[model samples]
Target: MATQSPFPFLDGLFERIAQGPRPPDWLVNEAQQRLVLLINHVLMQERAATERLIPRKGRVVRVQWRQFFVALQVTPAGLFDLAAQGGTPDLRFEVTETSPLGLAQAALRGDRPPVRIDGAVDFAGDLQWLADNLRWDIEDDMARVIGDVPAHTIASVARSAAQALRGFVRKSGAAAGGAVAPWSGNGPLP
Candidate 1:
C-alpha cells in the first residue's frame, strides 16, 4: 500500500519557495564566502586532504541546487576561494533532489542525495575520494574551544541525540512504506 507524508503541505511549501525570487546577490555572495572559509578550515586540519587538493589547484568547481549556486576555485595552498565570475567551471554538480524534507531524511539516514555530475572524469574521481575520506572532527574542535571534559560530555550528549533521531527517522521511513531503505553505511552513493 502506498503511504503519504503526514505533512503533505511541506511539498507545496517547498515548491513555492523554489519558484520564489532568489535572495539578493550580495547576500548570496557573502554566504558563499563564509562557506568557503569553513571548507578551508576543515581542509587545513588534514594534511593528506590538502595534499590531494594541491594537485587540483586553480580548478573551478561549481555546485548548484535550484537557483542557488557556488563556484569555488582550488588554490595553491590547497584551500578554496570564490571563483571569478564568468569563468567556465571544470566540473559541475547539480543536486537533483528538490524536497527539503527528503534531503533532511536522506542526511539523517547517512545517504547521499541524488546528484548529476558533469565535466572532467579525473576531477570527479578526486572529489569522490575526498568525500569518502574527509570528515570534520567536531568533538576535537569543540575540545579546543571549550575544555576537554565539558567538550567530551557535550559531544556524548549530542551523539546520543543524533542516534535517537536517526532511529526515529528510520522507523518513520519504514512505516511510510519503505520510501527509503535503512542505511547500512556501505550502500552505494546515489
Candidate 2:
C-alpha cells in the first residue's frame, strides 16, 4: 500500500504557494542579491572552495526549480556575481523534486534533493566537490558577534534540537514504510 501524507493539507498549501501570484521583480532581485552575498560569505570561509571555483571564472551557472531560478557567474576572484539576463549558462542544475514538504523532509534527513545537472563536466565536478566538502561554520560566525561562550552554548542547544528533529523525522519515515527514497546521487533525478 502507498503511504499517505500524515498532513494531507500541506499538499494543498504547497500547491497554493506554487500557484500564488509571483513576488514583485524588485523583491525577487533583492532576495537573490542577498542569497549571493550569503553564498559568497560561506565561500570566503573556505579557501579550497574559492580555489576550486577560480578556474571556472566567467562561467555562468543557473539553478532552477519550477518557475524560480537564479543565474550566477563566477568571477576572477573566485566569487560569484548575478549573471546578466542574456548570458547563456555554462552549467545548469534543476532540482527535480516539486513538493516543498518532500524537500524539507529530505533536508531534515540530511539528504540532498534530487537534481538534474547538465553542463561542463569539469565545472560540475568542481561544484560537486564543493558541495561535498564545504559547510558554513555557523557557530564560528556567531562567535564573532556574540562572545565565544554564549555562541557555543547557543550552538550546542541548536544542535541538540536539530538532532531531536532528525530523530523524529527518521521514525516518521520508517513508520510510513519508507515512502520517500533517499537520494544517492547515482540515480536519475526524480
Candidate 3:
C-alpha cells in the first residue's frame, strides 16, 4: 500500500513559497559576491586547488539552480572572479532538484544533487575534481579569529548537534516507515 509522507504539510508549504516572485537583482548580486568571497577564502587555504585552475585561467563557468545563477571566471591568480559579461560559458551546470528541503537534506548527508551539464567536458572534469578533492577547514578558520581551544570546543559542539539531528532524522524515518530520509540523499518527502 502507498503511504503518506510525514511532512506533507511542509512539502506543500515549501512548494507554495517557492512560487513567489524572485529576489531583486541587487540582493542576488550581493549574495553572489559573498558566496564568491567564501569560495575564494577556501581556495586560498588550499594552494593545490587554485594551482590546478591555473591552466583554465579566463574560462567562464556558469552554475544555475532554479532562477538563480552565478557566472565565474578563472583569474590569473588561479582564483574565481565574477564573469564580466553574460558571454558564452565554457562550462555550465544546472541543478536538477529545486526543492529547498531536498537540497538541504542532500547537503546534510554530504551528497550532491544531480546536475545537468552543458559545455566543455574538460572544464566539467576540473569542477568534478574540485568537488571531490577540496574541503574547507571551518574549525581552522574559526581558530584564526578566536583561540584554538575555544574554536575546537565550538566546532565540537556544533558537530555533536548536527549528528544528533541526523540521528533524529534516521530514527524518525525508520519509525514512520522510512519516509523522512532527508539526510539520506533521497526525495524530500520519501
Give the alpha-carbon lDDT of every model. 0.88, 0.90, 0.86
Q: For candidate 2, write residues 47-114 as lDDT tens digits.
A: 98899899899999999987889999999999999999988999999999988878899899999999
Best by TM-score: 2
Which candidate should be chosen as best, given lDDT against the real structure? 2
- Candidate 2 stretches greater than 4 Å from native: 1-18, 180-190
Clashes of each: 0, 0, 0
Q: Of 1 and 3, which scores higher on TM-score?
A: 1
Misplaced by over 4 Å in model 3 are 1-17, 175-178, 181-190
What would the TM-scores of all predictions be?
0.84, 0.84, 0.81
* RMSD, candidate 1, Å: 8.8
User: Which structure is stronger by TM-score: 2 or 3?
Assistant: 2
Candidate 1 residue 94 Cα shift, in angstroms, is 0.5
- Least accurate stretch of 10 residues (summed lDDT) in model 3? 181-190
**Ten-residue region with minimum lDDT total, candidate 2:** 181-190
Off by over 4 Å in 1: 1-17, 180-190
**C-alpha displacement of 3 in model 2, angstroms?**
36
